[model samples]
Target: MGFRLPGTRRASFATKVASSKSCEVPKGYLAVYVGEKMKRFVIPISYLNQSSFQELLSQVEEEYGYDHPMGALTIPCREDVFLNVTSSFNRC
Candidate 1:
């Protein structure tokens, strides 16, 4: 089954945060699309508190301004860079 990334249909973040496994976000994590193809990654919620990760969120906010077609938080960055940041978070 394809992982269901949030889309632009509506503001689902609040709903996703409240629901359980059936909501596609799993638990304590979120799905984001990275790279040109919009690749998807389900990342831990703790990553939100990291400065490096927050940088990416800022970029997303700047570009999308809470509205885009991808349904998921889109990170406009090289896959390697995204992976490197996330890998460090995994280590912590």
Candidate 2:
């Protein structure tokens, strides 16, 4: 699987909150990509506050024929991971 980093085209909210240092999803959540079958899937890292990881899993199941999304998960504050995340998405 390939890890796509968020870029300058990321969501406006994300871009504003993202400092020059790194990017972090508000509320401690992170987004990641996982490969299933022959395609890649986007999933929030750790777990969403109210959206629970299970919900994402269910979406993945319905869309990708898989019940789980897997990939390297890293929290905010980690410069490397943050940078990777920032480079993955597009900014408005």
Candidate 3:
């Protein structure tokens, strides 16, 4: 069975981007933009502590350096790859 580390919590990012209203991501979660379409995904803050996720953050730093225009962490990777990584992360 999957278990979460201490203080780790999962948050849902609804995939419905077609809505006129945007959903508010909770305080403990961060919004990341993924793929060519720049789809947004809200994830738990705990993922930042993972080494693999840190690699992605490195890329984000190189690209935007905390100056992300969208006010979200924009990841420069395919959506599938990001999803695959998060899927594995969820199990941890």
Candidate 4:
């Protein structure tokens, strides 16, 4: 059987560019784009404790090899995530 996903969550799954090379956005995550054309994307993380979250961010930076993929990063929801606003580096 084939499984299909919804539109709004397009970025949630892997994508293949015009090159035909398939690329996955990494499981358990979704990227938020910046600017009108959706140029850049940044990861989101929940759980307050600002300090701890920052630490987690540091780790993500190390793994992603880029400090703040975009000019902003957001952690949607406090206890339960919904959507990350990363456009301004804070919740939307």
Q: How would the candidate models be sorted by lDDT, starting from the highest?
A: 3, 1, 2, 4
Q: Write the per-residue lDDT of candidate 3 for residues 41-85, one digit (tens) a residue.
A: 767788889888888888778876887666777787888788766
| Each prediction's whole-model lDDT (CA) | 0.65, 0.37, 0.66, 0.35
Ranking by TM-score: 3, 1, 2, 4
Candidate 3 is scored at a TM of: 0.68
Give one digit per residue, the lDDT tens place, for model 1 in 1-92.
12222342332443343333443776778777778877667766778998989988898798768775777677878777887776665342
Off by over 4 Å in 3: 1-23
Predict model 4's lDDT versus the native.
0.35
Candidate 3's error at 16, in angstroms? Answer: 7.0
Whichever of 2 and 4 has more lDDT, that candidate is 2
Please give the clash total of every predicted structure, in order. Answer: 3, 14, 0, 1
Weakest ten-residue segment in model 4 by summed lDDT: 79-88
Q: Cα RMSDs of all predictions?
A: 9.9, 11.1, 5.3, 12.7
**Highest lDDT model number:** 3
Q: How does residue 70 of candidate 4 score in lDDT?
A: 49
Residue 88, model 4, lDDT:
23
The residue pairs found clashing in candidate 3 are: none
